[model samples]
Target: MGLKSFLSRPLAAYVAHQYQKWALHPEAAQQRVLQELLRLGPATAFGRDHDLAAARTAPDFQQRVPVRDYEALSPYIERIKQGERDVLWPGQPLYLAKTSGTTSGAKYIPITKDSIGNHINGAKDALLHYVHRTGKPQFLDGKLIFLSGSPELEQVAGIHTGRLSGIANHHVPGYLRRNQLPSYQTNVIDDWEQKLDHIVDETLGQPMTLISGIPPWVQMYFDRLTERTGRPVGEVFPQFQLFVYGGVNFEPYRRKLLDSIGRPVDTLELFPASEGFFAFQDEPGNPGLLLLADAGIYYEFIPAERFFEPNPPRLTLAEVELDRNYALVVSSNAGLWGYSVGDTVRFVSLRPHRVLVTGRIKHFLSAFGEHVIGEEVEQTLREALQQFPEAEVVEFTVAPRVSDTATEPSRHEWLVEFARPPHNAAAFAAALDAGLRRRNVYYDDLLRGNILAPLQLTPLPAGAFQRYMKSQGKLGGQNKVPRLSNDRVLADGLLRA
Candidate 1:
């Protein structure tokens, strides 16, 4: 038997056993995690500053450490980068996970040994749960291709620095590393387009059972693969069983990615950021992904509608109600305390603490009180794609078009790059406009009053978004199109690109 087959069965069984204990008693799991964080709190500088060493309970901890974001925590991060010890975490960080400067400029999120453990093992445990629940362990016996960034890290102020994906990819166990496709040498190719070509060449002949990447890049790789092989993905790798993805909401790309994959495969969604690996798909019957309450992270939630309150109420796992949108706050082993990661999520289950990533708390287009979110735009786009079954939108962004002249009333401009252009482009745009009308009351009212023009579809060339990302040095790894911007910066920039 192969090494993966020989080792996977016991691993899956153990993960299943552990998952049951965590899922059935989420509140208890969370409580334990909080207690652990509180224990570790005293050793670091942040803990002493907040009197975390003496803080005995969750209430005491909450009273001392308020909710903060990267801006608030920037000083500590800078200190850590300057070779300071026990600034955020217990000591100097092993690395700085460089997140794409989207909402905030490029953020160097600290990654300690403890935080990296959560990043790696959390994903592993989630996959193990999948294997245990599905009664399928054979997929684990084959090569698992992780479409990630360069593993070669640069030393910055004695701290290794690179993409979080790269750091995590560097740490894969020797056994799994053997099963992982694409050479480390090839994986480090900085140019994303060139990297993708090398990946396509390396993995095309492997026994690929599982593949993981952000959606747009996966679609790009799949298109290249299909064109080269003249075969569907299912035919190419008949044993391919799962597609694991994250970085952006999957609804818009679901049909397109599925079409490229050429068959239905069990898909798992992950909510991992540079800060920490937070949540993952656990159970089939359950509604959102199961929150990792027991992972090396303590979480708090603020209702999204009221997140702007001067002192918004922060709810713990036990306090978060089902079906309400909440902005996530986290205090992790990496030394971030009560930091809002900017993403908003809706809980689907309270029992196991499952959640759906709804939208970004900071990302929205409300130029005319339309209050449109990434989720809404993506939903509209998904529904619009239904009218043109043959066409697929690879990547897209939206901007509000406010006009000075009477000829152009304020409206939304969609800069969409199609993987497969629709047969009738006008019909596709109309369907998209109709979708927004149905989904958004403000949009519908604007249309009814003729205060808004029909949604403008500026169809972009294929790989337009990729080229823009490349030019910006953000071609891959958790970077994505900003879906709903209030200004025309992205649209205008894409035009130039």
Candidate 2:
């Protein structure tokens, strides 16, 4: 190993060991985080307005501040944009993480000096955990490329504003900078296709050991590399050992991705958002992501079934139970109070606060009172894929198809793009429907009552989803096609494609 690789081993071990101190005692760590947030709360307008200074406990804080989405808190955000000091966080934010997918177009999440570490450190620790556990730090000696957004920032009230990934680019550690690939000029290219071409040209012969990006975009890069070199990605980058990904679940693309590489590589899953970096996979074979308990954020949960209720109980870490779906709510040093991140999670291991991202609170199918979550569909697909080993999924989405005619029964429509189409399509569809029926009782009743017809699968061309995303101008950098929708907007779009 080189100097960097040798030094990284001890540093990685120390970081991982330090992290375990908090992860093992989550309730205590969370209490400390809440205390710190409360200490800083009195300095800001939100803190003063919510009477945060008087609040001594999580319940007191919860009673004073109501859970809200971005739209509900935009008034405070607006003041910050107008150069108001202490409107949200103390003084001014270091950066505003720009993201899309809201009805109000882009959302600008505050990244304060106090809270920026949560985003940056969370990513750093994920790698440290991997090196400490697997004892494989040789990747540190070679190029590590992060396929990300343009690092160029736009001014918003004198604050640097851009995609979270872009903002992160400014903070890449000095040590890793030498190993990072795709020159600044190539990274700043606006067109994703052109950017991919440049990246392929830049790294086609480099010693690339680690690749990180959203799975679909990374898959696109893999496709380009193989096509350009007339070799599998493993042959092209023989030293490549790690695939770090976030934004979306990795399972759906797992088979095709590995097939393209022609070998297995260590994969790490992260749960990151504009709001905060919440969790990352810490163990090699575990699907659960270790929640960052002491990472300058106080977490609260409302049972998924009660998420829409007017006064749902906000349960803290001690109150959360295993295997129950909860809507993740967070209050942070970034000045967000009782902010609903729109995600639903299930605690897989309460001892260390490991969770599985089940779905989004707003992203589900309940058009016919048969609520089908993202986890259910993804899990069902996994089960079905196990039965059909030859099948390979590129991407898929589900939407309800409400019938306009009384004689016709409404049904759920699945649009899937296959890298390798199934030999027996009928059997595959049957496996999916059966798996869903077993997992979701409401869907089972709907099927038995004839209220809904069996789900239909519409196969699309190889790159249909990519084409659709490109048309929407969301082709790259943390954008994901919603897995489930109540309306036919996505379904219709895929069908039209």
Candidate 3:
């Protein structure tokens, strides 16, 4: 083995050993994290206003601070944006992770010096887990391509402001800087299409080993590489060993992505967001991601059904159960107190606190009280795709199709874009409908009661989703189309497009 791999093997082993301590004793780790957050809470304005200093225990903290979304916390965020110090966390944050918001248009999430370690270390530990488990660390020797937002930053009240990925770019460790791919000039291009082309040109001849990004964008990169080289991704970059992805479920895009790669590759899934780096897949063949209990974030969960209630019951690590959907809440060292990041999760394993990100809390279909989630749709599609091995899904979304007239029955409409359309589309649709019924009793009851018709599949033109996203100016860098919606706004817009 060469110098890098030889050194990485021991390092990976050491990191994995250190990580397992917290994974094994998650509740203890969480208690410690909570105490640390509580200790730091008194230095900020939000801390003073919420009486965080008076909170001695989890219940005390919960009682003092109510769960809040971005809009609810924007007043303090605005104060920070206007150059105020110690508004949320201590003094000023190192950077602001700007994300697209629903009602607020744009959200600026604080990333303090205290909390940045969670983001960086979570990613490092995930890779280390893979290296230690498989004894394969040669990927570190070649160029690592991270398809991300531009590294360029704009100052917001003396703080560097950009997408979370962009903010992270400034912090890439010096050791790995030599291996990082896609030149800074290429990354700075504003238009995604243009940046992608420049990236392809720059890395076309390089020895790329690791590729990481949101699934869709990485797939796009793979497609461009294959189109240009007239060879599969594996043939083009034989050293490419790892696929690191997050932001969307990989199951839905697995077939197409694998086809593009032209071979099997080890994959790692992360549960990261603007708010914090929450979890990462630590074991091969495991669907669950191990939660970072000691990541300077105190986590809470409210049952998804009772999330909007006047006073939802908040459960901590010790109180949560397996397989129940819960809206994820956190009070991080970054100054967020009892903040709901809008994502819902289901615990698959409680021993090490492993979880699967089920869906967004607001991004569900409850138009007819069926209440289908992103996990259900993605899972149903994944199962349906299995029976029809020939079909390769590119992208898809679902929305309620309610008729204007009373005579017609309402049904769910699935807008799918396929790389390889199924041979028998009707049979595939039937399989998906059956799977949904099997998964959700409410949906099954609606079907049996004749209140809803079987779902309708609309085969969208290839690249239709991309075109739609492009039109919305959300073409790249962590933006994803919702899996399902309660209304026809997205479906109508898609059909019209």
Each prediction's TM-score versus the true structure: 0.74, 0.76, 0.76
Cα RMSD (angstroms) for every candidate in the order listed: 13.8, 14.0, 14.0
Candidate lDDT values, in order:
0.80, 0.87, 0.85
User: Pairs clashing in candidate 1?
Assistant: none
Model 2's lDDT to the true fold? 0.87
Q: How far is candidate 2 from the true structure (C-alpha RMSD, Å)?
A: 14.0
Q: Who is ahead in lDDT, 1 or 3?
A: 3
**Candidate 1, position 41, lDDT:** 79
Q: How many pairs collide in each candidate, listed in order?
A: 0, 0, 0
Error of 3 at 343 (Å): 0.9
TM-score of 2: 0.76
lDDT (Cα, 0-100) at 193 in candidate 1: 64
* Model 1, CA-based lDDT: 0.80
Off by over 4 Å in 3: 364-497
| Candidate rank order under lDDT | 2, 3, 1
